[model samples]
Target: PTTTQAGRAKPNILVTGTPGTGKTTTSSLLAEATQLRHINVGDLVKEKGLHDGWDEELQCHILNEDLVCDELEDMMEEGGNIVDYHGCDFFPERWFDCVVVLQTDNSILYDRLSSRGYTGSKLTNNIECEIFQVLLEEAKASYREDIVMALQSDSLDDISRNLSTLTGWVNNWILDRSS
Candidate 1:
């Protein structure tokens, strides 16, 4: 039976996008509006040491994918996790009711990432990833067609619109659960 049939229930939503996209901002806003747990996978990985070691080339931690998955299994099973991550396809599709892939203009993404001091192949690759809409394609390929949403996040207005839209969805979902 559904969690509603028993007692409490919450839906899991995945907010993913390229590094320079607004995944963190949008997800954080969404979390605040809905009062659901916002799990930043990158922070979790760092906090839990769910990684092999630092990637000297990438200038980031080398994630132990399995360990990350193991650590998140409980949250995934529990059902209220709003996961914020750069990669989305690795997550179990069933763990999410909705997968939001945020998009941004490559030029804007480039400037945003550059402001953060990203350069070389690291920066180039990310800009390219955003330009190609890789994350959106990945989400669509990995999840149910109806559940995958491609949202633009190039401006503050876009972010606010997205936050409002997602906030409404969460409200309706929770209301449905209670009913």
Candidate 2:
């Protein structure tokens, strides 16, 4: 039987993208609108004391892919989680109903990163990552093509629309799975 919207099971969602692409913003919106638990990986790492600083220690820890996977699996076991991260390659496709990849104009991304205190090497590297479509490629390779989507997040209205579209998709996912 189909549950009422109030009793609907929230599907696991992966909101990912390159830096300055609004992954965090979109994930927050979805969590607010759908009442799902928001699991921002950055925050999780911080709370876990996984890394000490942004130096080599932190860099090495964050780059440990296996550790990230294990931690994510543990986190998702509680159910109804929105895993907000920068890429999707490490996550299992079977666990996620949808993966929304947020995208932004290169110029806008450069501006956003610049305003956020990134400069020189860091900003240039991220711009290159976005240009090369690293996150998009990761999503495509790691997830079922039909479940992965690229969305533009150039403005608040765009984010709102994306959130609505994704929420509706989650609802449909639940209905389809139950049938």
Candidate 3:
């Protein structure tokens, strides 16, 4: 959707990926550099009690998608938000101007998840999710292909490069909206 339709001067971006793929770090830094609000959906779910219940197998909250969407609707309509989440299919497509799916190499992702104490089915499922590009595909299916991008997130350099690319995009978005 166009910024004009939302009456927004800035854009809303969704940064998503498999767990340990740097969605939080990238979105946090991007928000700091671009002055956009960073909404970590996981954190939001916990903070707002917007969940059905805990998922015993997943070791995470069973997010109440409707509640989460309702909570975010107004801010999203106003734009200038960098939403960090692992899954994308549940979010409303119109909430974002750009969708970034960060990908990390399988081995690196394994190590990262391992260090984070992820084990058994949780770790195995996440690794498989990355290997299969689940999140990237979900984003593409959920949003316009032109607005969805997959960026590397295996190292600090990659994160820096992504930040630069996204910062430039943000500038262009503003210019395009203004003109």
Top candidate (lDDT) = 3
lDDT of 1: 0.87
Predicted structure with the largest TM-score when compared to the true one: 3
Scanning candidate 1 in windows of ten residues, the lowest lDDT window is 1-10
Please, what are the lDDT tens digits per residue for candidate 3 over residues 1-179? 54453588899999999999999999999998999999999999999999999999999999999999999998998888999999999988777889999999999999999999999999999999999999999999999999999999999999999999999999899889897
How does each model score on lDDT? Answer: 0.87, 0.79, 0.93
Candidate 3 matches the true fold with a TM-score of: 0.96
- RMSD, candidate 3, Å: 1.8
Model 3: worst 10 consecutive residues (lDDT sum): 1-10
**Per-residue C-alpha lDDT of model 1 across residues 1-179, encoded as one tens digit per residue:** 43331243888999999997988888888888888899999999999999999999989999888898889877777777799999987876678888999999888998999999999999998988987889988988999989888899999999889999898887887888786
Estimate the TM-score of every prediction: 0.93, 0.85, 0.96
Every model: Cα RMSD to truth: 2.3, 4.6, 1.8
Q: Between the candidate structures 2 and 3, which one is better when assessed by lDDT? A: 3
Once model 2 is optimally superposed onto the true structure by TM-score, how far is the C-alpha of residue 122 displaced, in angstroms?
0.4
